[model samples]
Target: MKVIGVTAPSTGSGKTSVSLALLSSLNNSVSVKVGPDYIDGSLGSAVSGKPAHNLDRWIQGRDFMRRFRWLSSVYDFAVVEGVMGMYDSGSPVNLSTDYYFRKIGIPYILVIDVSKLAESAYYIAKGFIGRNCIGVVINNFYSEKHLIIVRKAFSDHGVPIIGEIPHAEELKIPERHLGLKTAGEMPDIREKAVHFSQFIDFSFIDKLKDIPLIPEDRKPLLVGGGNIYVAYDNAFNFYYGESLDFLGRIGKLHYFSPLKGEIPENPHMIYLGGGYPELYASKLAEKSHLNHALKTYSDQGVPILAECGGLMYLESTFESKESSLKFPGIFGGSVKMTGKLTLGYTKLNVLKDNLLFRRGEVVYGHEYHYSDIEDSWEKTMQNVLGKGIQGYDGLYSMNTQGSYSHFDLMRYGKRLSGSIAKFMR
Candidate 1:
């Protein structure tokens, strides 16, 4: 599909606003995503009424990542919201959002916050934009003079300022440390989307008409049969649109919520992307039915991939600041919230060719979580702990892999699906 990336300097820079305006403005749109994402999928689907896929490069492998690249032939357009700052999304410089732009070669629509500066906004935009830039959206403009300055910034960069969204009357509410609280978490989020779209130049789609179509050779691998159930809900929410769309390209992908119900039935594969499972540990624990369902399937050798909270859930127990509770007990360890912060960019130097990752392959991605091993519970997970680049910790495991690595599925490269498709087929 014709994909364009939506990016910003840091959180709350109107990436979602620009994304929504574009989704609402276009038809049959999807979102490629990154980070411990939830809000983008929530809002993107709200605007388009389609299930958005999580295309996180960090958490999975290439085969799973591009499972749906051929979607361009199925949908009108695809919009990808960048992970952290363009370059800051990963643990190092190369793994940044800017790096992903070049990796995927998707043209970008740079969203600049005109709050602190007007004409200087161009520099902020210039700093974020790499060579693949296609357009711009000047969000949070204050006055007529501000618009002139922002317009000039785009003109100088040769990047069209698609929309100069004004200081949204709705965005002024307080935010938590993670980022803007979800619109679903807040009732006014819908109104905010509607109100924010007013400021965006909705007609930017017209300019993209000349943007060339992606060649068939580069499309994601396609599949016509077999079951692949992905976790899509308030919890287990870390997903990218491109990744999921790509998955749907190759399998009969279905979604089941870990938040509200049981995992979908009799699936051959399960994908659990990232999300704040720590927030709902007790409730998720209460879903003994679904928990056991996954536990049984994992035990039965259904190929499964879970990241972040999904990884946490597979453990024996989940402990966050809220409360500690029993987990599905599928993996080999107990996860307890660490008093010290446990978060950063990580490079997974592949140890061996296993079910998912290859031997000696290094993957780039980020890790952000407040949990760690409990000193009291060390013996249960003592053998499983891993640390640093190659995860030299040499920890333990079941058939499943649970890690803070958070690498992308797409970058596992073509060997990703090529290798795994045989097992499922």
Candidate 2:
């Protein structure tokens, strides 16, 4: 498939908007985000009508290429939406999108928001122009005269101006503390993307060459797990596409909405991912049936994994400024919504055996949340790199495990599947 990346000079530079437009304009296109962002990928999936995957070199390492090849082989084209700035690194140690672009050998289009600058836009664009940069897309431009000045400035540079997007309020995606709202929340997102597509020149895609696919010999590792229930809704929809794919290979996936107080019957395993649970805290707290069911399942030793918002939902109460609401209470603690945002990549040293990881195993994941556990909690994993609750994470009760760290199945699939297999035995 012909692959192209959409990157920006900085965050909120219209990269997701441009990427969504490209996906809407292309045929049989699939999308991937460069980091552990769940919201942008959801927007891409909505525009493309397919599951959007994530490529985190820090988490997946060299295996990212294998997953990329597998994704390329399935679609006619792929649009990779970059995380943060093109060269912005998570840390001094972690690699960035520029590294991935060079390693994957794909050219990228630099997106620059020219709303605030006139002549300086060119200098900003010029700084980002590199070997892998194919062209530039000027976003949030004022008028014909504004576009003329920026175009004239770039006239000296050999790089072509692929597109000029006007400053339109309709193209903007609503944002909260986490980032852009999910595509489901914004029903007209696809229409907005289509509206944005009219401003862009898609002729560059025609000249892009195809990437050869590599053969995949990987096989399913888990066995004898009958049913795996996953929490999926507006409150709990933060999940990696590959993580769900791996689970589907091992057993049947039954998605239930915790907001509706739904729970699967006789579940072998349960997965509760991260999402805006705090937003729907009261509604979720009203689901006494789900809370009781989850608690009972945990008491029965059913393997359960919860991350971030999921971890909060398992706590006794969701404490907010208005009032405190009840939750599953599996962790016997209260989670209070905080103004302080905890966001970063994390490395975990597993202190105890869990459903998806073994004791002493080092796992790489990320944490992004605005909530903190109020009551003191027991911990199963030690945070070696990023911030954790007093250098500890992974709260476990019987067979249930909850943590703020979110894992990518591309890196943890084999180990996770094996752990599931062992538990089934």
Candidate 3:
């Protein structure tokens, strides 16, 4: 299918808004986010009636691009919403919008903020103008005169102005510390999506052409053979859509919430992804039965996979700015809330053979957390890229595993599913 990327000069330049508008304009189009960010992908998923996928180079490397390109061929058109800025790259590699555009070999439309510019919009577009940039989209232009001037500026330089979206108060999405609220929580998503689509010009939507379908097999992975309990709620909702999809394919996936004081009934394995666990530490601590259940399960050697916020929730204590709360203490580490933010893409080398990874095997992922464990423990993975710090990550104890790194299960589904299957066995 024809693929196009939507990028901005910088963050908060209406990239996600424009992407959702474009998705609404197209007849049969889907979108993906080009970073480890789950927020924009969630919004795009809600706006467009499709499960949004994240295409991060660090997590999946180059293979994900090819796979996504192939998978997107099923749709009439595909759009990729970029993260941060157009040229911003992650640490230790060229994992940015430019890198993905060049590697995926797709043309991108630059979204320029015209709220503060008229003629200067041309210069802004020029700074980002390259062979990959097919056209430009004027964003936040409230006045018709400003839109005309910005359009004329690009048009004068022989560059096409594809769309001009006006500044609207209702267009701004509600956000928390993590970013935009998950689409499920966002009110009037459909109404907002329709309103945003009115700002875009759909005449050029025909540019997206169909591509040859390369045969791709979609076989199911090794089944878990047992029910899997997944921690999911506002406090622990940072799971990738692909990860949940894979889980559904492997076993009967059930969701439980520590905040609700509920534990799954007889779970074979517990998968806690990540989210704002620190925000609800007190509520989680109040759930005595849930803590006891988790501790009991760990003592019984039931396999558990926890990441980032999940790691914090499984800690002995979760210390936040407001209050200190106790957890299961299944893992001895204690988490401390701090102003410091640890965010990056990581390449983890397995230090020892485990169900999820083999000895010496390398796995790629991302980490974004503000809380830090108070004490160091024996680590199973070594960080080759990003700030894994002190050459170690992931706390391993018996059948329990916890880490700060969030992985791309879509790219590594087979290996992870096989590991989960083994855990069930």
Can you give the TM-score per candidate against the true fold? 0.71, 0.96, 0.91
Error of 1 at 24 (Å): 0.9
**Model 2 off-target regions past 4 Å?**
217-222, 415-425
Mark the 10 consecutive residues where model 3 has the least summed lDDT.
208-217
lDDT of 3 by residue, 1-425 (tens): 77778998899888888788877767677778888887787777777788778777777766675657556545767788988998898567777888877776777888998888889989977988888676888889978887888788888889987777888887887777677777757768767877877877766657655444463655676575667889988788787777777777877889987779888787877888888887778888999998999988888777788888888888898876666788988788788877778887888889986546778888989888777786466788888875553557777877788888888766765655665566566
User: When superposed on Cα atoms, how far off is each prediction in RMSD?
Assistant: 5.7, 1.7, 2.4
Clash count for each candidate, listed in order shown: 32, 0, 0
Tens-digit lDDT track of model 2 for 1-425: 88889998899899998999999989999889999999999999999999999888667766888888887657888899888998898574656888788878878999999998988888988878888777999999989999898878887766788888999776789999999998879999899999989988988877888866674655765466668899998999899988988888877899999988887798888999999999999999999988999999999887888999999999998888989898989998888877899988999899887765789999888999987786576788899887777678888888888898898865775555554555567
Poorest 10 consecutive residues by lDDT, candidate 1: 375-384
**The CA-based lDDT of model 1 is what?**
0.64
Q: Please report the TM-score between candidate 3 and the true structure.
A: 0.91
User: Candidate 1 on 168-221: residue-level lDDT in tens?
Assistant: 565654455445555456665555666666766655555554234443444556
Clashes of 1: 32
Where is model 3 more than 4 Å wrong at Cα?
211-215, 389-391, 413-419, 422-425
Query: Considering lDDT, where higher is better, how would the candidates rank from best to worst?
Result: 2, 3, 1
